[model samples]
Target: MQQATPLQARVEGGGTPTMANWSLGSEAGVLKDVLLGPPEGFRWMGLENAAWSSLVRDTLRRGYSFDKQLAMRQHREMVSAYEDAGVTCHFLPLDEYNPYQVYARDSSFMTPYGAVICQMANPRRRGEYAACLRFYLERGIPIYDMVSSGNFEGGDFNIIGEKTALVGYTDHRSEEIAARQVAGWMKDEGWEIRFAPIDQFYVHIDLMVCMLNERCAAVCLETTEDDIVDWLKARQIEIIPASFKETMALGCNVVALGNDRVLSTAGAKDLNTKLRAAGFTVYDPDMTMFTWAGGGVHCMCQPLNREAA
Candidate 1:
């Protein structure tokens, strides 16, 4: 059995030591283990923070129905795709009150050192940190730190390259203060932090920008600022554009399984086709039940162990 590590692993003066067992250098590395949330208790949060998420608001406006059984089936399919890719899946303990816990990427995110717990913006979702905390502790994964400044979610913490990250905030779900707090930690560790301040309607940076591999990414030029795009280009990283319509629909949100493999949704036909043409093996699962609820596969998962890029 693995010995449990301390809840706080971050060094006060920075230069925290990296975990020997739990390693993740970049998002595009070969995914060996991933963290997921339970889908059994998932349900639509009608009128509860609906104003905070444009996708949820639009779903309510369109009078779309929520089918729990369908959601479970879709979630299983997503897991199957991950398993087929040889990625081990770890799930958080279930909490009936946190139905939105199915979107696992919001509560906390993994780093090279440990997991950084986040502060949820919505009151209804704040309890999610408990399950996240329990999971990491039980698994002996170190806890790097927690976001105490303001509201911040895991989706906004996007790692684009080695020692480089794109931290985003909307002043709504993820505030600038919290983004800086997290950025400060990364900066002190000799990382290059790029702040992307986007509109609240977009939710998180992962919604419009997700790394496809070490050298490529799927980005929504319409939603992403010019400076961010230029920065990526400056690093010789290729950009794969996703239409604004598709991006808002959560089509651009995807996961890189390394070796040119991607986990995308069936709704992302255009991007999936483009990815396939680019010699990538894509796993397109029907995730409308979750996507319509305002999160996608990327939003539903957190990488725990990724082979160094």
Candidate 2:
């Protein structure tokens, strides 16, 4: 509740953050050059990431898993979706890490300077980032720090801009450190961070908020705190409201596909309308299954390289 400090208020003229200056969750560490699709006949049972959540569940019958054949079919669909969006995907061969990590949530949170690989919030998911150790090392991504406390999920933090970030959780599912830790880390990076409250109703900041462009962002005002709103307004950010219904359907979980173009779930019509009006190019995929699992576009893709604009 203190006034914005001079350090917090300082801005480097508002630019995109470089990958070296970022922290990323490691599970989704599969590199784009080697990203893999699910195998045939393998129905994903339970996906921790909501964007792929439903597909993992609904792709099969109860008390059963998708065999190799079905898994490959599911993978084809996922690959097709990304290709349709003009995403240049690279698939790595399968390893102990499996496909959950390919989504990059387990890799590390990316800031403007370096990477922060997250510790798994789920015991079963621990050490997934370890699988990508070679990938980061070979690529020259630096590890400035790491999370050693209770479980933390990188999906929960949303970087609204170069100087600001939003963090929160949905249930204790993801520790508050995801928010608090990221905020503190960014503070050292000279960033102004804010913690927002998320519920099972909205799992992460990405579920309720997204940056569509340099000057425009989308969020469901109903779920965000007033402080976040005021902070964003002060930065000259244009607020596009996503309805509660849209938020639930993971409307705000958008991925900037680059060039002011993005990918989102098909169900967020109202939010999409606002985005189009804001001069954005929005693309939708067959996200009915993913939305049901509680994640959408943003959850599906882990961006490895985003050149600052």
Candidate 3:
């Protein structure tokens, strides 16, 4: 019989052991497996949670209608794109109460050592963690630790490269105290952590910045702080600027499939063109149903096993 993976794999005094089966050192790696949320129960959070995000607020303000069929179709297209890119897709068990569970990247994120289960800020979405916990436990994936300091979502945790991370927090969704707590844990694991403090309106740091490869990143200069830009440059990373207009549309929020390929949205025409011009194979899928609800390709899925960069 095979030994079962522990629920918590993090070491008490630091130096947590890395995963031998699942390897992911950076966001730019070639993805092998990905975790995606189910779209079956998705619905607009409605006026009750309009203040949840600017995008959702705008969607309501525009009187946009919710089409479950269209949303599911878009999700299938997205999954097809990933499959075409040679990625295996894993879906979280459907939960009727957690409509926003479609945004899988928000509940938990993966790390070199294991997966970190996050504490969600929104009361309606807190139950999302239960699904995440069950998925990891069933798959034999180690749980590094759970966030208890404060509310901190997975989107705020950005892995730039091996042993380097950029942790972000908006006092609203992700608190500074929580970000510091996560940073401290990674620091003990010998990681260089950079703190990114941004406005709550932007939601998460990934809205304006995402690494395309080890040597390149797509960023929205207007929304991203100067210090963050300088930090990326300091590491000798080439910048691909996405217009603020596009970034607000969730265009800048993209997924790197490694091997000079990227998964972006059709609305992100400018960035897609630029990426293709830069010698990248870009998969442009129409995801208006999700993007208008406040997430994009990057926000909908979480990479599980990735080839080391």
* 1 against 3, candidate with superior lDDT: 1
The residue-by-residue lDDT of candidate 2 on 56-115, one tens digit each, is 343332434325554344445656656765656643234554445544543455554545
Whichever of 1 and 2 has more TM-score, that candidate is 1
Taking the tens digit of each residue's C-alpha lDDT, what string does model 1 give over 1-309? 755678889998688999878898899999999999999889988889597799999998999999999999999999999999999999999899999999999999989999999999999999999999999988878899999999999999999999999999999999999999999998988989999999998999999999999999999999999999999999999999999988999999999999999999999999999999999999999999999999999999999999977
Off by over 4 Å in 3: 1-4
Q: Pairing residues by index, what is the TM-score of model 2?
A: 0.72
Best by lDDT: 1
lDDT of 2: 0.57
Clashes of each: 0, 57, 0
TM-score of each model, paired residue for residue? 0.98, 0.72, 0.98
Clashing pairs in 3: none
Quote the lDDT for 176 in model 1.
Answer: 99
lDDT of 2 at 31: 21
- Which lDDT value does model 1 have at 85? 100
lDDT of each: 0.94, 0.57, 0.92
Candidate 3 lDDT score relative to the true structure: 0.92
